[model samples]
Target: MTTSTPSTPSTMRAIASYRGLPVDDPDSLQDIEVPVPQLRPRDVLVRVRAVSVNPVDAKVRSGLAPTDEPRILGFDAAGVVEAVGPEVTTLAAGDEVWYAGDITRPGTNAEFHAVDERIVARKPVSLNWAEAAAMPLTTITAWETLFDRFALTADSTGTLLALGAAGGVGSILIQLAMELTGVRVLASAGRPESQAWVRQLGADGVVDHHDLVASAGEVASDGVDFLFSPHSKGNIEAFARIVRPFGHITAIDEPEGLDLLPLKSKSIAWHWELMFTRTTYQTADMAEQGKLLETVAGLVDDKRIRTTLTKTLPDFSAAGLREAHRLVESGRTTGKVVVTR
Candidate 1:
């Protein structure tokens, strides 16, 4: 998520929050001078070329005042490495790289950032910064949701239901499932445009989340083998009814308390996949993130995975980030939004 230090000047221009509140408020985002980090042995200093907005950025901005430091925003970024610390062995200055920065750090909405080599990867050579920036966060989420949480085996002899199948994570998840696994993929899209969007992304079928079970029937009568909900609620009991016995359910959203009693009868397994969990907790698998990102980059290079960038803005200005935040919060965005510097 973060490196110990950086080999650079002491300061850089970055977006930060001095107050915690709604992102629309001018005070919630400000351009500020922050220390250019000094990289640790395993750290790399990146000169950021582009950054992208996600729901976590807004939530983080809202909780800004919780810390004494100015809370900077933006997670996904692509750029060129400017310097590396002594202990770093994987990369050197001038290599193109991309990463979804650690939630515990100052973020990527800056001219320079220091990140651990274990969490950074080579940017796909086929894509530009903006396009590359749109991927890391969503890709990490979707990949982990499928492989880590759902325990999807190599054979993929299963059916998968993807809720919120038109948003950033869903957009990428559908493609990964269809391309990498044999699992039949079903997605939920509330709008006609969204339905068409998911269908184009290689979903076997699209169902309206408004009537989840009915749509599932129209798509597949026997019920799915795995259910993924980016946003979930008490009504998720309906999903329990539709998933096959012993099937797994994975969610990224923080749903309020719900009764697990219903799922017990079916011997269902529930998993929560937070993309930052490994980095945040410093799990032994932290380096696995680097490995996964490299695999994703290869997929991009081979044309198996497409960049999800749908909206682009110029510069790392606070106004641009606010607009990107507004778009993500609106819940109508078809793919990732990037801000180029």
Candidate 2:
């Protein structure tokens, strides 16, 4: 085996997995030591203080196969910068920051991690580390789905329906639509508690997915102008019935299959929003993520939006990570779940 250089620092603790296993399996996550990452020219090294769990984490972990190297899994993080690469100009040691790290590389489940500077932004001053950590991944997903995929603007006036509004992405999307745009929002939630939660987030009305058509029709007689489906893929026919002709539908879930034939009659526009696409493809506008995070930080500081963190584990240990993943996989979580060092 290759040895570390004499001057290189030793390993850092991380919660990682060696093979795909069910969330309840003890072997699904383990505490281990990993060598500190070396930085690329556009990279910034962060001393991670907090991280949040999401559906993608569980999905990716469930599909991961055994390998010699363990896979660290976490996307959203808040931390202090420990070092910067030569080409990294916007951040430096001691700078407080938050980011949704690129999915194409090792993630933020370590004591320290390196991330591209173009995808990071200063953390919101109004929130603590865990709260800040909870926002990035979900914020990026909601923001991109609303503005990039739907092409919505502040002046836009129409009804926007959010399916599964009690989850992280939906909670934030409801607030974004209410605070940043003139659109009327109709949020769908199956449970009474979830319905109340979305209403607290400023949803103009709440609908039940089981009674979707009737409940949605009560909100918008002319049909909703946009549908943000974070869940409820089985309700596509209801979506077709309630959405206006040429209305836009955006989603982030990985349903087994979606048939567009139902939507063809209305000429509905369908769009998929995967927040990692920019960093995964190294897109030309990857820096736009940093800019958007800065905007979100400003919104949070101004009280225009709030962090959606509803649960936080005690520490950044393997047990903590596993518990967080279990809560995410449970499907009953109302908001975000975080782990802090």
Q: Each candidate's lDDT (Cα)? A: 0.86, 0.90
Tens digits of lDDT, candidate 2, 88-146:
87887888999999999999999999899999999999899999999899899999998
TM-score for each of the candidates? 0.95, 0.96
Clashes counted in candidate 1 amount to 6
Q: Which candidate is the best by lDDT?
A: 2
lDDT, model 2 = 0.90
> Per-residue lDDT tens digits of candidate 1, residues 12-66?
9998887777868887778888788777778899999999898888877777655
**Local error of candidate 1 at residue 271 (angstroms):** 0.4
What pairs collide in candidate 2? none
- Consecutive 10-residue window with the lowest summed lDDT within model 2: 1-10
